[model samples]
Target: MKIYVMVDIEGISGVYCSEQVTPASGRFAEGRKYMTEDINACVAGLRDAGVDEIIVHDCHGGSYSLNWADVSPEADGYICGTIGDSRYVDIDDCDGLILLGYHAMAGTAGAVLEHTYSSKRIQNMYINDVLVGETAVDAAIAGEHGVPVIMVSGDDKLCAEAKRFLPDVVTAQVKKGLSTQGAVLLPPEKAHRLIHDKAMEAVKKLPLIKPYVIPAPITHKIELMERCQLPNAAGKPYMNVIDGRAYSVAADSVEEARMRSGG
Candidate 1:
């Protein structure tokens, strides 16, 4: 079986503060090590499960977040650079997709490092009137091609978010968020073991998990963090201004809506 793994930095094991996830911060190097090791743990589990192909996508921040030298050699391929371009992986043929190190969406109370696609510009996002984070959007994109999101790993809030949206998606909670930046964390050793075991469990439960499909003719709404962004959004041909800080776009595909609205 082929598996695609999508990674983000904020929810990575051993990561707790904003500085650790920020590339410019001196503490970010420590977070990078944690990110790579967590990915390796997942890769090891998938390899042991007899998966033939494992593709890892560095979906966090311009795709330059991963520690390339430390990534497991067992992984078949690595996707890097700016996301949503030609370099993005084609998940159409993958049997399952794993969302690793993802956080809850913006406005999620008690979610560590919570934010949707953009922390600075975006305040909230919704699809078909349901609030969603990156997890749902990415899963919906994969679902369009019939691939199910089998597993997710992060803090308790993120795990809860995954379970609420995907239902059957296996989740590994490595930390418990007390606030946006504070969390009761698990040691790296324990976190890795959890991720490793969860990867195997997710693969085993693949038959019962279904792709997260959003209804067609989807309406995507974006609420900006500030009203200043409204003028810029109103000029976009694809955008329909809902109010001073919000805009909506109608599209048949999630990808199109995201691309058109710059979500």
Candidate 2:
């Protein structure tokens, strides 16, 4: 079995500040250590379940939070960078996708370092009139390749939000949040153990998990915090600009919207 993993740092255990998520900051290394350990446990669990191949991607800001050399030896390969459409690279060959160290959308109460794709650029986004975070957006993208998201690991709010979109997905919750920048973290060791068990269990039940899909002829909108962030073709035939800040697009699917926006 083959699995693809998309990992972000903000939702990792012990991570709840800009110093941790910001690349090249003093706390960055510590944050990466937590992320690496959590993913390693998941890889170990998948291996025990007979998984043969694992592909991991660093989905943190700028896609460079993880040190490729420190990634799990069990993984077949690691994606170190992003190119607009990089999130779903080689997705078709995988049976399942796992979201690691994820968080709730920006402004979500009791979530650690909450935000969508960009905390500074995006204010909020919607697919078919339902507000969505990165989980939903990215899941729909992975669904285009027929891969279901079977597992996820993050804080309490993130796990709850994920269940709403991926009802049957197995999740490992690592922390309880007091505020966006505050959380009662699970010890690294404990968090890792939970991840290992959850990964194995989710993969074991993979066949029953279905892809998270958005219906055809999808209508989506992205409300940007800054007007200047709006795409150049915002007012075209299938797209529109609201108040010069929010942009809406009508596409056959989420992938189509991303491709059209050059995301």
Q: Estimate each model's TM-score.
A: 0.96, 0.95
- Can you tell me which runs of candidate 1 are displaced by over 4 Å? 83-88, 231-237
User: Per-residue lDDT for 39-109 in model 2, tens only?
Assistant: 78888989988999999888887777776677779988888775565567778989999999999987788
lDDT of each residue in 18-135, candidate 1, tens digit only: 9998989999899889999999999999988788999999988878888999899999999988655422378888999999999999988998999998899999899989989999
Residue 82, model 1, lDDT: 62
Error of 2 at 12 (Å): 1.2
Best by lDDT: 1
What's the residue-level lDDT of 141 in candidate 2? 91
> Any runs in candidate 2 off by more than 4 Å, and if so which?
none
Best-fitting candidate, scored by TM-score: 1
